[model samples]
Target: MSFVRMGIVGIGNMGSAHAKYLIQNEVPEAQLTAVCDTNPEKREWIRSQSGDSVQFFDTPESLFESGSVDAVMIATPHYSHSELAIKAFRRGLHVLVEKPAGVYTKQVREMNEVAAQSGKVFGIMFNQRTNPLYQKLRDLISSGELGDLKRTIWIITNWYRPQSYYNSGGWRATWAGEGGGVLANQDPHQLDLWQWTTNMLPKRLRAFCGFGKYHDIEVEDDVTAYVEYENGATGLFVTSTGEAPGTNRFEISGDRGKVVIEDGKLTFWRLRISERQFNKEYNGGFGQPECWKCDVPVRGVETGHKGITENWVSAILHGTPLLAPGEEGIRGLQLSNAMHLSAWLDNWVEIPLDEELYLEKLNEKIEASTFVKKSQCAKILDVRGTF
Candidate 1:
């Protein structure tokens, strides 16, 4: 097996988590070669945690300039994701970017273009896509076992956060730092899951948002979006950071079955649909298809973040096919952007959304922003709910 040297930019929560996993698990084909962070305190802490033997730098450029790493994992704040990933790619390094690939669709597209030009593996940290229940649900939909999907409703309100959580960082809820609220941070995984399982793109989006309903922030704390796809299939996405005792329930209905991904489990109901109804040509009930539901156990074993991360390293070193391609990330980001645009303008927006328009709207919010955010949580509310 070929061994790949690894470097990490931004030694924050996710970065630190990745560092720990790399060092402790001893990924068979990967090695932790360097770590980077802007904060002196964080730099010192990483040195203490990893000892003097490993290299540490204060800027991503320094790490990339060293040319000692084969790949770099970016766990920085949202704004820097695109720039850093592009930089790493330009230096002939494979990259694994943390979720919400970038703060906006345009930035994510630029990173994707750079990755394509560089001819190196570019991966997104959509770890939830690796979860067993979600995998099973995706498989069912792809296999035709679920038949033609009609509607999907994801009531994922369980992403509860308190006021102090937002206060933990100045950047947490600010438009300038993070972009949006629930959609950017807590719900990127869910948004990506929406696209992955549906296997379709939206035709239009309409939404209503509650801006800072429970938190003192500029962006939304809760949001509800109604999406229509090209085939006339519809979807409902509901997310909130203020709701307590929340539940994450995803219900996807098709002509043959309905699949629910919730509480780390997959439940599916297989239905018998009537070809007979079509053949009968009834005068009164001409279009209605008769159906009966039967419970079907989701087929697939479980795998989570560790599985995806390990596979990512393996894919880089051994050419394994990716679970989630980096380019597909833009789809979810576009969906989020369209929803926010719809809610902000109080109108429905069509899909294949205009990236320039979204960026213009984002810039407007950035110019208008007044809130002082200091940490990750603050930035979270600002951009997360926007989408």
Candidate 2:
């Protein structure tokens, strides 16, 4: 194929953002051939954006089988992601989905298998993976410059969203519609980045969550989770959508030193020697390892969504490796689930999550929800710098 015929399933905020850039020919080996959205308002919007060149399908079934595109990008709600991806895979098309792969891992696991069997390019929109700050962090960890991980703490309360943002649509923040709150909607990137950089998953976790703590929503808006890794490294994750004048800071401490990412800068505290070795060799009673604070230079601007879309096209046409493979999405979602499950059960949740139990508890929350969803209207927001 000269270029991958790209189709998008949801033309809401994120979807429309991708659609606009694609229509503008921002991605090198991709073209906007078609778009599918159940909302008629979205259809009208897509037409105005793509003119007569792009075909609009009201249903995924039509778009997948219509022969209008060679690949599909799914930007639907949290629950429908895996189901639609599986369908697109069965239709013999490449699939690129938005974050949090699915509400639960069991369903996402099935989708991964189908994608592997299809042998099609399956990717998730982990745009934060393209950030230079995080990319450098992963390099430092993988290259052993940071030695073994000791602890990680990220207070990412900058996901600040007013109640109006949640009230923009009925399906938002409701357990039945959007699954969870900040973790599902706002902080998937941070959740994904935490492990993507460290290459470690929590062995067990204890979390405290406040559902509708700062908003009139049925899902969590504030959360504080404590997690432990297999290697004995512990982490603290704190996030909220209600906190104003919020702070965004991530610190990764390792045997060699630690790196701090805040205010769009990476500060590396390098020890002259590994802490493990220092403990063995230091003769001074209380002297610590000599350290130097270096401003680790992170070059290049983060490509974000447009970059991921371009990478997906490159993978489709030339066998280039995807920056954010779809399978890796499950790991991040697993962390999110662990935290939620811990809070729900009011106990520590272990790894290898009990998928059945998670789903059961999730359903209980949904069944218990008395707040009625208002409307699934396409009230698209101007999501310029959301990620």
Candidate 3:
């Protein structure tokens, strides 16, 4: 195909924003040929916004069967990601899905298997992967510039949301709807980046989650999780939607040095010698390894959703490798599920978590939910600083 004929499912905030970007010629390789949403008002709004150049469909199945698009982007709810992506792949259309893949790993696994058999280019909207700062961090760790990893601490609580925000959507922050709260909605990028940059997954994790601590929602709004890697390295992840003017600091320590990303700045502490070597050879009782403070320079700008869309288009047209493959989406979702399961069980959960137990507990929450959702007009905030 000379240019990808793209269709977008779910005309919500993210989907509409992507449609506008494509229509305005932001992604030159993609054309907004078709759109689908269950709501007739959303379809009319998109047609009015973009003129009659785009086709609107009432159901995703009709959009897929109409041969209007060669690729599809799924921006639907948390649980529908896998189902929509699998349908796209089965229709011989490339697929790009938004983050968190799915609420649970089991469904995501099935989606991945179908994509593998279909031989379609499947990608996930891990837009943060396009950030230059994170790219530099991944390179440093992978190149062994930091020696062996020791610890990681990320206090990411800048995702403050008022009660009105949660009340705007009936599907939001509900066990039977969106799955989980901040971890599913706001923290997926950070969680994805954690394992992506380190190139490691936790062997076990123990989490303390405060359900409805900040809002009237039934899901978790505050969490603190302690994770352990197989190599004896440990980590701490703390996040919440309640704290105002909160911090977004990520610090990683290794035997050779340490790197810290905060306030949009990347800093590094370079050790003169490896800590293990220094400890083995040093004779002095009180001296530690010498270090030099350095500022890690990151090249290029932070290209968010637009960059990922362009990359997805390139992958479909020219066989360019995807920045975030759809199969890898499960890794981050696994971490989110593990944290929730650990909190529910009140104990440490191992990697490749017990999926059956997780599903059982999650179903219990859904069945026992007594949360009375409020009725409020949906408001789509400017999601610039939230990322």
User: Against the true structure, what is each candidate's TM-score?
Assistant: 0.90, 0.95, 0.95
Task: State the displacement of the C-alpha of residue 103, model 3, in Å, after optimal TM-score superposition.
Answer: 0.1
User: Tens digit of lDDT per residue, candidate 1, span 218-264?
Assistant: 88889999999887789899999988899899999887767777676
User: What lDDT does each candidate get?
Assistant: 0.80, 0.89, 0.89
Estimate, for each residue in 1-387, the C-alpha lDDT of model 3 and write its tens digit.
889999999989899999989999899989999999989898778878788989999889999999999999999988688888888899999999988898888778889999999998999999999989899999999999999999999999999999999998776798766779999999999999999999999999999999999899999999999999999999999999999999999999999999999999889999999999999999988999999999988899878999999998999889899999999999999999999999998999999998878877776776555432333211111011000
Q: Model 3 residue 217 lDDT?
A: 90
Q: Give lDDT tens digits, candidate 2, residues 326-383.
A: 9999998998898899999999999978988987887677665553333431221101
**Model 1 residue 332 distance off true place after TM-score fit, in angstroms:** 0.9
CA shift at 299, candidate 3, in angstroms? 0.5
Better of 1 and 2 by lDDT: 2
